[model samples]
Target: MEVAQVLHMNGGMGESSYASNSLLQRKVLMLTKPIMEVAVTALFSTGATNFPASLAIADLGCSTGPNTLFAVSEIISIMIDLCKATKQEPPEFQVFLNDLPGNDFNTIFSSFLPGFQEKLRGQIKRKDGAWATLPCFFNGVPGSFYGRLFPRESLHLIHSSYSLHWLSQVPRGLEGNKGNIFMARSSPAEVLRAYYEQFQRDFLTFLECRGQELVVGGRMVLTLVGRRSDDPSSKECCYIWELLANALNEMVSEGLIEEEKLDSFNIPMYNPSPKEVQTEVQKQGSFSVDCLELSEVNWSVVDTEFNPNVASKDGGYSMAKSVRAVAEPLLVDHFGEEILDEVFKRYKAQIADGMSKEKAAFVNVNVVILLKKIA
Candidate 1:
């Protein structure tokens, strides 16, 4: 499948839309907020006199929803507070929200931006009861981040949350990867090698592209799903896909899906270890890692004090909805839309059973890295 064309979070504000099901990603963002704050603060602390008059920021893979603007808002708020504390005028803000072309940019532009701007203006109102007019401009750029998306040296601060794990495309030559949809314990050595090689190429290209786009001393903070273990097929990263494959195999047995279809499909995602990511950054030679952290969040953490309405009596259902929001479009493109509900129904049951038996097994490992452009 052409991943760029097919891969997008389920759009619109429906129950199954990514906007509703993105609590996990939102939690990850909150967990990494301090790292982002530090990155932005460090950017200004390096040379306050040299701070740009118009600061440019990009949030890559910024899918539409509450989470889309969450990080951007946090970054801008940090800068505003820092400027106030340091007694410096805040720079005019230029914000870019980027994702694939198939993303629901309309929801963002029509439903969110106006309110965001109004609220931002209210926040920056002067003590004299006049508007400070911070002059923040928001633009939507649609494309894959695996390639160049901006003018050379145009960005000052870059942030991406829970997005980098997606490969540009499914790896080539995965005939040996029958019955499984992604890297799993049962996958062959060749299957593992192919996935890692594909990630290396894609990640190196990502670093190189951002290297070209970010000015010297610019900062980037990236948070993506990753595993702590060096083993590529560890359960922390691949078990979800394994459960999904089991669901598909069951359908195949029931003749709801053809065996050949299940055999041919593979998810275009990779959860790299911290070592893998550090190795690639060293190989790319464009940015210096300032901070690297590995963290974990329970898959069953559907409800929190921050969002009481998001709770689920069925943890499996909550997890299934999250996966469906992100994977349904890709699954529909490949397997036909008729099987979606049943597939997820079975997948949800599998998750519930697995979680009940082994509650500790259901955690998502995440990697958050702060980098500065040095070259």
Candidate 2:
């Protein structure tokens, strides 16, 4: 599939929209809040008088949701607090929220932006002379973050969360793999090489682009799904796709889907290890890694009203909804919309059964990095 066109979070605030079904990603945001605070504080502490008159920040791969606003708000709040603590006049904020061209920007602008702007207006500000309403401007920049999106030396900070695992496109030379949508335990060695190589290329390009856009001392804090192990086929990274492939295989056996279609389908995603991320950053030769952390987030605990006591279909359903919101558009584009509900229903059932029988604890091992641009 043409990933950029097909791979968007479900639009509108309907039941399946990303806005409604993004509790998991929201939890991730919450978990990473402290990291953001530290990053923001460090950003301001980098020589008080060495700052620009205007601070430019971009949240890359910022999908439409409460999480998106939450991030920007957190950074703004922290920056303001830091400025006051340092007894420095706060710079005007230029914030950019970026995602794919197909993202639900209408909902973001019409529904979320107003409240965000009003909240910023309400924050008690330090008496920076002649300042009004905190002088923060928010704009939506729609495009892929893998390439250039900002002018040279325009950004002071860049942030992304729960993104970057998505490759620019599916790895090539996978047509020979039959009946697999992702890297499996049984995948050939060359398939793994193809995926790793693709990630290397794409990640290097990402750093190179950001390197040009960020000022000399600018920082970036990013959190993305990654693996703790060097092995790419570890369960932490591949189990979700394994379960999904099993669901599709069942449909193929029942003659609900053609087997060839299943074979041709592949997801454009990669979970890099911290070492892999560091390697690319170093190779790109533009940024110094300040901090790198790996944390495990349980799939079952990712909910708005998570009850640890209840391991029921409800949890399974919640997980399925979260995944569906992110993956449904691509599935619909490729398999037609008719099979969408049934497919997720089966996926939910499989998850429920797996959790009940094995007490399966699926996790996303995430890597949060803070990088500083080097001259």
Candidate 3:
């Protein structure tokens, strides 16, 4: 499958859109805020005396919505505060928001930019209390980050959140992974190897490409879904997919979806362990891992926080919508648009039942890493 063409969060501001269901992602960003602040502070402190006139920043996998400019806004706020503290002029900002070509860049440019600019202006003020022109420019670059997306050494800082778990394409040699849409307990050993190998290849390419784009002292803050255990089939990462597969299988049995289609389909995603990520960075040899940490967020808890009304009705409803916003486009591409409603309906029921039986929170494991280009 052409991941760039098919892999995108559901767009528009409807009820099921990513824009509405991305509170989970926003929570992840908030969780990593301290790390991001430190990374930015270090970048400036290393070159406190000689600052660039223009600062280049990129946000990879920046899907449209409220979360689109969330991190960039925080970074700019921190930078502006740092400038004030040091009595130095803040540099002109060239911010590149990146995602696949299919991403809804229109929403970002038309709906978000105006308010974002106004908010920035309000934050940046001169000594005489007049608004200072920070000269922040916004550009949307459409492409996969696994490949070259920027000119050599053009970026000063890069931030990616809740991306990178998506592989560039489905792993080759997954024929044995029948009845599974991702890494699962029932998957064969070869299936496990295939997924890991694919992650390694994609991640190394990501490192190599970003290494060429970031300046010598540039830093990167990346947060993505991950697992704590070395076992690829661990529940923290694989259980959600397994539950999803169960829902699909029920459809196949009921003649709603073809069994062959189910067998052929696999989500082009893998949640790596911290070790796996560190190993790839070491192998790539382009950047040093400054900080790597793992954290888990209970889906039920997040739902309660963000969608209390819906959560009160059915805990699975909100979580289901969140997954649908991210996975619907891919499902539509593979299964045709006909099965989406039934698929997610069954999937939601499955999640509700699974959560009840497990008695433990349904959590998404996340890995946050800080990297600096080797100078």
lDDT by residue for model 3 (321-369), tens: 8999999998999999988999999999998998889836378899999
How do all models score by TM-score? 0.97, 0.95, 0.97
What TM-score should be assigned to candidate 3? 0.97
Query: Taking the tens digit of each residue's C-alpha lDDT, what string does model 1 give over 118-188?
Result: 87887777422343688898999999999999999999999998889999999997899989999888889
Clashing residue pairs for model 2: none
Query: Candidate 2 vs candidate 3: which has greater lDDT?
Result: 3
TM-score, model 2 to reference = 0.95
lDDT of 3 at 360: 61
Residue 28 miss distance in model 1 (angstroms) = 0.5
| lDDT tens digits by residue: candidate 2, 32-94 | 888888778877887532777888999999989777788888888888778777787788888
Candidate 2: where are CA atoms >4 Å away? 125-132, 304-313
Q: Residue 239 of model 1: what lDDT?
A: 87
Give the clash count for model 1.
Answer: 0
